[model samples]
Target: MNILIFGYGNPGRGDDALGPELVAAIQAENIPGIECQDDMQLQVEHVTDLTGRDAILFIDADASCVAPFHFSEISAEKDDSYTSHAMTPHALLHAFHTVYGKDAPPAFLMRIRGYQFELGEALSSDASENLEAASLFIRNLCKSPYAESWRSLHRG
Candidate 1:
C-alpha cells in the first residue's frame, strides 16, 4: 500500500523537533512504498498531497499527550477559516474531502510527547528517548505491507 507520512514541527526548538527527527530516521532507511515528507507546519496545499495514497500518517509533537506517543485516526472536520496559516490533520482531511468530493485516505495522527519548545534549543534527553521509541514504532509500521491493521487497531 502507498503510505504518505507528513512530519511537521520546528526543529529549531527543543522537543518540538521530535516530529522532524522521526521523519529523518524513517527517511534515512529509504524504505519502499512509503513517502516521507516534513514541514515546519501543516498547510492547505498539503491536503492535495494526500490524494491516491492508501493511507496517510501525520506526526507531530504534543505536549499534552500522556504516552510516549499516541496514535489516533483522523476524521474530516471543516475549519471556519480556510485561509489560516496552519491546519490540523482533521482540517486538512476536510479540505481534501471538499476538493475531491470524497473522504481522504484512512489517516492517522501520531503525537509524540514533548516537554519543551524553546527557540534555538537542542532536544532534551527525555525527548530524545521518546523520539527513539516513537521512531522504532513508526519504522515497524512502514515495514509492514499495509497500514490497515494499525488503522483498525488504533481508530479513534
Candidate 2:
C-alpha cells in the first residue's frame, strides 16, 4: 500500500498554488502508508524518486479542467519535454521506465481546476472553493482502502 503523493505548482501564484497547497493539507493529516511531497514544478531528477514505490499520484493545477479536479490514470507515453526544465508526469514516467529498465509504477494525475494565476497574488475565492472540495475528496481517499486501486482502473 505504499503510495507517493507528488504535488507541484507555484505557491506564490493565485490559483496555481492548488497542487502544493493540497499536499500541505494532506501531510497535516499524518495518514499511514502515504508520503506527500511537493515542488514548484516537476524535474528530471524526480524520475528516480519513484523507485520502490507501488503507486504514484501527480497533482497539478489546470486552468481548463473541470472544477475541483479531474483524476485519471496515466501511462508512460513518450513526451517531447525531455529537454525542458519542468517535466510532465508522462515524461517522468517515461524516464523511469527507460532508466530503471522496468515498467513504470502505476500512476495517476489529479488536475485541480484553477481560475487565477497571477504572480504574488493570493488564491482567488473561486479557487478557494475548489481547493476545499479537492481537499475533502483527497481526505476521503486517504481513509479508503480502495484509494490506491485507482491506478488500476482506466477512465477514458
Candidate 3:
C-alpha cells in the first residue's frame, strides 16, 4: 500500500521545525513504499499524490491548550488549515474533493503541542524530545499494511 505522509513546519524556525524533524526521524523500517514530504503547508497541488494511497497522515505542531503529547485523528472533513487547530477537517476535505474531484485519499492530521515557535535557528530541547516520540509512531505505522479503516477508496 502507498502511504503518503506530509510533515509540515518551518525548518529554519525553532519549535516550528518539529513536524519536519519528526518525519526525518522515521528511520528505515519494513515499510518500503512510504512517501514523506516536509512542506510549509499543503497546497491544492498536493492532491495529485492522493491517488490510490492506502493511507495518508499529516503531522504538525499546534498551539493548543493541552498536554505536550496530545494527538488527535482528524478526518478530511476537518479544518486541517496547517496553521491552527481551529480549522475544520471536513471543510478542508471538501475543498480538496471539490477541486480534485470527489476522490481525495483518506487522510488524518496528528497535531502535537508544547511548542514555542521562535524565530531561531535551532529546536528547543523539549520540542526535540517530542519529535522523537512522534517519529517512532510513524515508523511503526508504515510497517503495518493498510486496512479498510483509513479509506473509502479513490481514483488513481
Candidate 4:
C-alpha cells in the first residue's frame, strides 16, 4: 500500500465524529489502493501497514488545540504529549520506526478543527460542515499520479 489514510474519532460525540465521517465520504470517491480505517484506539500492531507505503496521512479530531488545521510530517523523536487527541500518532510512528528501522515509510499528520466533543445524536452544524472539507482533502491526497485528474472537481 502506498498510502494509508487513517482517521480516528468517537462517532457519538458531536465534532469528534469527524474522523469516522470523513472516512465514509472519501470512500465514495473510489480512489484505488487507498486504504481507510475508522479507529478509536490505535495499536502498535497497526504499524505493519506502513511497510512499503510512500506516504501516510493520519487524521483525528482535536479537543484542546487552538487551530483547526495543521499539515506536517511527524518527527520520529518527538513525544506526543502535545497532541490534541487522546490517541497519539507519534507513538505509532515511533513504534514503526523502531521495528522497521529506516525502512518504515514517512507519515504525515492532518487534523480537523472541532470544538464540541460532547455526546450527541448528530454532528454539530460547524462540525458537519467541516466533514465535507476534510473528506475532500483526503481524496486529493489519495488520487494517484497516473490517474485522471479529479482534484479540480472538488470546490470549496
| CA error at residue 78 for candidate 1, angstroms | 1.7
TM-score of 4: 0.77
Collision count for each candidate, in order: 0, 0, 8, 0
* Predicted candidate 4 versus true structure: per-residue lDDT over 48-68, tens digit per residue: 876777667677877554344
- lDDT of candidate 4 at residue 85, scale 0 to 100: 40
Query: Highest lDDT: which candidate?
Result: 1
| TM-score for each model | 0.93, 0.92, 0.76, 0.77
Candidate 4 Cα RMSD after full superposition onto the native fold (Å): 4.9
Q: Is candidate 2 or candidate 3 better by TM-score?
A: 2
Q: Which stretches of candidate 1 lie over 4 Å from their true place?
A: none
Residue pair clashes in candidate 3: 77-89, 77-90, 78-88, 78-89, 78-90, 79-87, 79-88, 79-89
As a TM-score, model 1 comes out at: 0.93
C-alpha lDDT of all candidate models, in order? 0.85, 0.84, 0.63, 0.66
True-structure RMSD for candidate 3: 5.8
Question: In model 2, where do residues sit more than 4 Å from their true spots?
Answer: 145-148, 151-156
Badly placed stretches (over 4 Å) of model 4 are 64-68, 78-87, 144-156
- In angstroms, how far off is 38's CA in candidate 3? 1.4
Candidate 1, residue 58: Cα displacement in angstroms equals 0.5
Of 3 and 4, which scores higher on TM-score? 4
